[model samples]
Target: MIGKRVLSQEPVTLAEVKELTEAREKEGELTYEQTLTMDYCNKFAKLDKKKAEELIAEVEGLEKLSRRHAISLSDLLPSNADEIKLLFSKEHFVLSDEEISKLLDIVGKYKG
Candidate 1:
């Protein structure tokens, strides 16, 4: 099969964002989109690699959440319920405070 175009509306983890941006960088020059992706990746890179992975895992563990929402959480690694709610706004689902705390607990475990 030939190459397929990816829809950018979906949320992707910052790790994936970084990987894709770096690959594009090696291919010659970064496109405007690539530059934006790299910029956000750095901006949201508050957690180290392991902690980021934990955040992803935490977000994925929540029930009633779509994969896009989970990846968005991993990308932002937000520390509070408000930010999580904002990320889930387009997802059409609202997480409860207890659930938000659960995710925060998992992410907080790895925050050094």
Candidate 2:
């Protein structure tokens, strides 16, 4: 197929990627790039399967948050509002203290 441009947007998690990669590898279903990416994520993902899933669930449930930002929160797991604010610095948006506190509380739950 020929195309001028394609715009794609989707939300995904490292845990999901790992699971898919494992399945693909078992079935001999992936390309070289996919295999390499999966290997790297398995080695470097910040949270393990369980914690990552939990955080993704909690963060995505927040109305003010995007799935992408939720993934970042799962990855960084910031402890303070200041830290979270820094994560959001590139956005043309700001969160209230209460909102920041709520997000931090969710992040703290699985930190240990």
The candidate maximizing lDDT is 2
Model 2 C-alpha lDDT per residue in residues 20-105, reported as the tens digit of each score: 78888899778989989888877766677788878888888887788799988887778899999999989878888888999989
- Which candidate wins on TM-score? 2
How big is the RMSD of model 2? 3.3
Kindly list the per-residue Cα lDDT of model 1 for residues 1-112, writing each as its tens digit.
2797766776656777687788889999987887988898788766555556666666666688666666666556677788777766776567788987887776566554
C-alpha lDDT values of all predictions: 0.70, 0.83
Q: After superposition, how far is residue 6 of candidate 1 from its true place, in Å?
A: 4.7
Candidate 1 collision pairs: none
TM-score of each: 0.67, 0.72
* Candidate 2 positional error at 90, Å: 1.7
Clashing pairs in 2: none
